[model samples]
Target: MAYRVQGVVVREKDAPATIETVIVPDPGPGEAVVDIITSGVCHTDLHYQQGGISDDFPFLLGHEATGRVSAVGEGVTEIAVGDRVILNWRAVCGQCRACAKGQPQYCFNTHNATQKMTLEDGTELSAALGIGAFIEKTLVAAGQCTKIDEESDAAAVGLLGCGVMAGIGAAINTGEVKRGESVAVIGCGGVGTAAIAGAQLAGATTIIAVDIDDAKLEQAKRFGATHTVNSKNEDPVAAIQALTGGFGADVVIDAVGRPETYKQAFYARDLAGRVVLVGVPTPEMQLELPLLDVFGRGGSLKSSWYGDCLPSRDFAMLIDQYKLGRLDLDGFVTERVGLGDVEASFAKMGDGTVLRSVVEL
Candidate 1:
């Protein structure tokens, strides 16, 4: 059977996200249907609206989500009805080379449902990151549903579905921040601030937050940033150095995808420190730096895709931390909103006042 549900969709390039009647079909083989409990309005959803991600019009927005398994398709065994889960885009194919190498996090062939959700007119809607959840219920590859703690706050832990996971994974997974290390994160947006929280969770002694917004810098402090640098007034690299005993931080994460911010992250780390880029850049953005500097830097340069996270492992662990009050996942939730407020939340994103505007069903 099929169900008609209201979902947020962008019908044209540069169009506003709107509520539409989405037709969610019954789960096909290897697919499942989820009844969304909460979903986060992420910048990726905005990108979908503005055509930054793809030209697929009538794109179903919202990927960061937690929900329950309402129905399962044939061949599904890992999850059953009523199971609470965090939705993940990467449904790793275990036979992929990356998975065979014991690094399934880099799975080359991630899975998405072959069946498409559509409008009443039968126009297929592209699911953002293949896990659109702004609607009441959504269809996805069964593997995309990572079973999570039933008691976890859907509004908080569901963020692991995207941006929050990226940030925390940038520091802990990709950057591998160690205890007593000095860490600096550039771009104190949700992801950047989450990087600070990751560093703190990993026991970094000093965590520096950098951004142009002073208020955001203040917000970073609550996430365990020991020093805040308003890059608007001073050279961020210099400020980071000053905060780290005149040297540089052991790990520097670039959460802003712009080339300028990447350069700052490159120069703001110690000679042998790691540089991790967790930001999502546009196609037109380009980077040019001295090859000699790259060679002389003597440190690793890495890009974090989904924070290099393995949802099967990371999500449950992070949720455990959130439950233990070690990770402030709740703090990341700036406001709770409904599906109608998603488009408005996009406007609030630029103002730096909100970290995440979660849509609770």
Candidate 2:
């Protein structure tokens, strides 16, 4: 039987998201229906409403979510009913070349539910990132659900579904931060702070957080940054070099994804140091650097897509770390709001007023 549930949807660009009744079809082969308990309002959701992502009208907005499996479809054996899980966007196909080479994080073929969730009028709603979850229940490929400890806080762990995971994975997996290494993260939003936490978790001795806002810098300190640089007032590259014994950091991550910030990240690293770009840039934005400097840097210049994470491996490890108190997942949750408050939450995001405004269903 089909299930009708309330969800947040943006019918057109620049329109406020409204709570509408959406029809969720029963799980088909290799799919599962999840009773979403909590969902995070991310920048991606806001982008969708603003038409920054695509022209997919009436897009189902939220993606970062945690829930329990309420039903499973035929051929779905890995996840069972009542399992606590976090929904992920990437469900790798093992046959892809990236997966064949054992780097499933870059899998060219990812899977989503074969079925569609539509409106009462029968208009098919495009799920954001293939996992629209700002609703009571959502349907997804079984592989998109990563089971974790049931005792973990839903609002906190749900962050792992998107921004938080990207941030943590950028530092730990993409940057490959090592003990006693010096690292600098530009931007103190959810992703930047997560990079700081990940750097600390990896035993980085000196973690420098560069941001334009003082409040965000303070939040970065709480996430384990050893030093803070207000880029708005001073030169970030110089500040980073000054913080690291007149030599730049061993690894620098650009979390802001602007051409200017990317340039700072490039020059703010020690010779042969790594630079990781985790920020999502707009299509019109282009980055340019001196070819000589690129060659002279002599280290890896890489972009981290979803933190280069293998959900099966990274999710459980992060959960274990959270349980052991090594990772402060709760610090990421600045406030918990209801589904109706998502639009207001997006307004606050621009000013860094809240790290994450989670929706508790």
Candidate 3:
């Protein structure tokens, strides 16, 4: 049997996302149907609305979500009905080359539900990141559901399915920040601030937060940034270097993902330090650096995809940290909203005042 529910969909490029009747098919052999409890409004959703991600019109716009497994199809055993799960796009195929090398986080082959959800008129809806959840129910590959504690706050834990996880994993998994190390993160948006929280959780004592906004800089301190740099007034590279006693940070993460910011990150780290790019850049953007300087910078330059995270492992552990009061995941929830406010939430993304406007079902 099929299920019909209300969901958010962007019908065309730059069109406003609207609530529509979504037809969710019964789970297939390796699929599971989820009843979404909470979904976070992320910038990626806005990108989909603007046709930045793809030209697939009538796109289902939600990925960072937490829900309960309503049903499972044949051969689906990783999750069961009544299990609370965080919906993830990284449904790692265990047989992939990366998985074989014990790095499932880098799984070369990931998948989503073979069956597509669609509109009442039979137009197929493209699920954003392959795990749309701005609905009462969503269908996904069984592996995309990571079972979590039922007691966990759906709004907070659901964020782990995307942006929050990307940020935290950038610091802990990709950056590999160590105890007492110095780290600098540029861009104090949702992801960058989360990186600061991750660096703090990883035992980094000197965390520098750089951004063009003073309000965001003040917000960064609550997440464990020891110093804040308003780049609008001073040079971020020089500010970060001075904060680290003129030696530069051990790890510099460019969350802005622009050529200028990338260059700043390149010049803001210590000689043998690490530079991690967690931000997503546009396709047309390009960066040029002298080969001589690239050779002179002895540190590693890395780009983190989904924070290089292994969902099953990282989601549960992070939730546990949230439960223990060690990580303030709740702090990331700036507000609780309903599905109708999604477009308004998108308009709010520009001012940079809110962290997340979570839709609680």
Expressed as tens digits, the lDDT of each residue in 1-361 for candidate 2 is 9999999999999999989999999999999999999999998899899998999898988999999999999999899999999999989889989999988999889999999999999999999999999999999999999998878999998999999999999999999999999999999899999999999999999999999999889889988999999998999999999999998999999999999999999999999999999988987999899999999889989999999998989998998999999999998998999989988999889777999999999
* Reference-based TM-score, model 2: 0.99
Off by over 4 Å in 3: none
Per-residue CA lDDT of model 1 for 1-361, tens digit only, reads 9989999988999988889999999999999999999999898888888889989778999999999999999999999999999999889999989999999999999999899999999999999999889999999999999998767788999999999999999999999999999999999888998999999999999999999988998999999999989898999999999988898999999999999999999999999999999999999999999999999989899999999999999998998899899999999899999999998899999777799999999
The residue pairs that clash in candidate 1, if any, are none
Q: Please give the range of 10 consecutive residues that has the lowest summed lDDT in model 1.
A: 147-156
The C-alpha lDDT values of all candidates are 0.93, 0.94, 0.93
Q: Output the worst ten-in-a-row residue range by lDDT, candidate 3.
A: 344-353
Q: Candidate 3 on 45-132: residue-level lDDT in tens?
A: 9999998898989899999999999999999888899999899989999999999999999988998999999999999999999988
Global Cα lDDT for candidate 3: 0.93
Stretches of model 2 off by over 4 angstroms after superposition: none
